[model samples]
Target: MDIRFLVTFMEVAQTRHFGKAAENLYLTQSAVSARIKQLEEYFNAALFVRNRNSLQLTAAGEKLLPFASSLADTLEQARATMNEESIQYLSIASTSNAWDMYLKHKLDEVKGHLDHVSIRAEICSHEQLSRMVHEHSIDLALTTLPFKSDDVEILELSDSMLSLYCSVGIIEEALEHFNISIDWGQKTNEALEKIYPEIKKASMRTGSLQVALNYLSTHNSAIILPAQIAKELVNAGKLHEVDSLSPLTVKCYLIYLKQSKDARLKKFIEVFKGMIENQQGR
Candidate 1:
């Protein structure tokens, strides 16, 4: 069977429209139709049933779709594995601050293990990271909070705390520090809800911790951030911890699909586990 035909069939099956599939594949609509027809001829099965304005996969098509997708995915994974690139390509998803803080450090330790591994970082919510991992779009994920899942293994890397901070210059001059608040995440928001109910309305809201830091740096206000992030700025005299909520301890977790036996992944987990262990021992 032609892989190209299978590819075309899968595309059309997904979109359920020849024109849309062709657009996705960068081919002409007529060409896509021809390919689908050829595939049907080869398979001797009607893959799609078309009404006046709707498309539905026939029983044969329904059965074939999963196999075709798995084959394509296997091919892609095979390429990813056998490529002689210096760095093994690794896709990672995490919140911005976690990426900024630990990923670089971990990458430095793991670089020697691969010829070269390309690192792709996406700053997303924990749930989004889990979804991406499940879709096989990401190889691993780093998160500062725990997620509920049995399929994904959560490796605890470090115990951390969140604190409020800002540039030293800004903090020094601010009078009504009462207007300060955090960029409210479910974890931090709930923490704040319980710990400091007085600070209900956020002075600013940001999607990422980095943005909250930037906002705090530029304005005479306060932002609650991970203690590790706050630690750096505070040590540099660029920020200080607000007394209202001094610290909030949380675990930083490295999450990945529980497929325990990929060599590359195993090597990475070993390296990172050692690195973190050594860091803690010191």
Candidate 2:
């Protein structure tokens, strides 16, 4: 049996909701369903009795839980041991949007600050970053949403402001026709929903404003961008800010475990946090 199938089972069993399990495990619902089906087939028994309001473990599932728990614990310890061997290199990661907005500027500079700094930087999703932090697989993560946890320190930084912007030649009367939609987090989304239902009607949706920035150069389009970045483009005669509407404040957070069993990782996270605080004038 694949270990991942067991892990998926455990997450589903704990959450009792397939959609929640899929989100927590960074998997699609279909994938989680497939794994559960495979696990049930392996044991030749129904593992979960699903109903409208709840999911209960069957007799076979109850029997498998203890063994699964033991194996998963051992597997985690083994994985931790493997991670220790790579302690010479600390891993830091963030969602692609967060990295592009905040951390990308300091990537090369921070790598040289500490010894044993074989820093591994990756751009992944928010759920992936959260899992890495909980598993002690990565030293730090930056995300658009605050990951609240008693075991982690979340530093909220309000260094970004998002506002509507338009290409230099875009016609004001056609604002709805040129929408470049991007998910700018919950608060921004709510504010946008009130005024820009056209965002939903937009044919172009992207995660990065860089795509829209490139497109806006030749094509007339409207996009939301960090106020500072939009200012730079406006000064360069590429885009203009739409001042008729209010701007949204967008915040990003830096996340790291409050404590780490790995001594090297602990020290590095401390240094990185201090660097971030200093940059924000905190």
Candidate 3:
């Protein structure tokens, strides 16, 4: 069976709308419909219940979902392993915030331990990181979100606390006009919303901590930042923490395939373990 059909089926199952799945896969709606029909015929079962306003998976589709995901992942992993001799780089995927705040430095340290391994870091959203890891597109992932997969191993790195921070003299003015928000994770977002329900709009909203730092350096802005970073800036007299608001905590995790045994990946995991140990010691 063509793997593309399984891919199309999984996409439609995820999006639940053939049109939306077609858009995401860059295929025409007719093509997507044809692929679904092909897969249904091959399996001798109707995969989807077509409703006028919504689409839903039939019992067969539901049963096939997990198998499809596993097969796609297995095929991708086999391809990557087969091409390993030709491609000599370890790919690391991270959220922009994690890349900026921590992983970049740790990866640099990991590079020093390796002789000739090249490391490529890609910044992506939290949602995409798990899929990339499952597909073997990335060797490792650093994220604040707790990602669970039977095919992957997850290590708890540390808990980072986020606190409200601003420049020296305009805490009040910054609070009113220059409040910024960062996407820490779902839990932190919900906690922040509960704490400041009236503050609907921010002067700026972003996922990059580096961007928020740059904006804060030149402007009288206030934002929530990792306590470690905010403390470093405060020690340098560049930013100050708002003493009134409590801090929100987020847990960080390092993720990789359970079956990964690449030399570069093992070396990086050692470095990450040491880094986590050092952080815990402090």
Candidate 4:
């Protein structure tokens, strides 16, 4: 039996839909179906059954699940180990907001501290981060929210303050910066909605900070930004703090495989945390 057949069977089993499995595997649906048919023939057992438009595994498939999963994981681990031994490489990734809020600033510092290892930094979706970390495709992942996975350990990194800013200060000197929440995670979004009900009515909202800043550079709307960055822009006379709405507290999180103890990843985490502390002290 071909390993590709097992791989296709696993994908189909996981998704329970040939079309979805094909899309994820980047193969034609007919190809995926053919592979599954070949796999069933090789096993001399029907692996799946269709009922009420829903796909389900037969007893044979249920028994094969553990073996298939173990084989695929072992093969992937072997490939990753070979690549790591050949290149001495480490990969880190994050959602765009988390990348900007945490890892982006300290990446160069991490590179310097881990100069002997090659680093690949990436911006990816939360799902991609979770999947890559679990599959050993990425060494570390930073996120605005933690992933609930038995395969990975979740680590709380730091809480970053995001403030509201505009092009000009309001006439209210009595206003002071206060703590609020923006849409970094489920909790934050709920908090934001609870506190500032009007935020829901705002005509413009965005996930990318760069887009907000570019819009604020010429427009009159407010943008939520990291407090440190907002301060620097304010000092440069490019933006002003909008102190009425209060700042947002976004907690950073990290995810990595539970079995991983890579020294390069360990060193990068330590250096990055120290940098955050130093920046806070300043």
Judged by TM-score, which candidate is best? 1
> How large an RMSD does model 2 have?
7.4
- Residue 248, candidate 2: how far off, in angstroms? 2.1
Per residue, candidate 2 scores C-alpha lDDT tens digits across 247-277 of 4666678788664556776677667677777
Model 3 per-residue lDDT tens digits across residues 86-157:
545677888877776667656767677665667788889888997667545578898877685666778887
Query: Would you list the C-alpha lDDT of every candidate in the order shown?
Result: 0.70, 0.75, 0.77, 0.71
What TM-score fits each model? 0.66, 0.63, 0.62, 0.61
Which residue pairs in candidate 2 have backbone atoms (N, alpha carbon, C) closer than 3 angstroms, thus clashing? Answer: none
Weakest ten-residue segment in model 4 by summed lDDT: 173-182
How many Å off is the CA of 57 in candidate 3?
Answer: 26
Lowest summed lDDT across 10 adjacent residues in model 3 is found at 243-252
Task: Report lDDT (Cα) of residue 139, candidate 2.
Answer: 76
Best by lDDT: 3
Error of 4 at 184 (Å): 2.2
Report the C-alpha displacement of residue 147, candidate 4, in angstroms. Answer: 1.5
- For model 4, the local distance difference test gives 0.71
Evaluate model 4: give its TM-score.
0.61
**C-alpha lDDT of residue 115 in model 2:** 57
Sort by lDDT, best first.
Answer: 3, 2, 4, 1
For model 2, what is the C-alpha lDDT against the true structure? 0.75
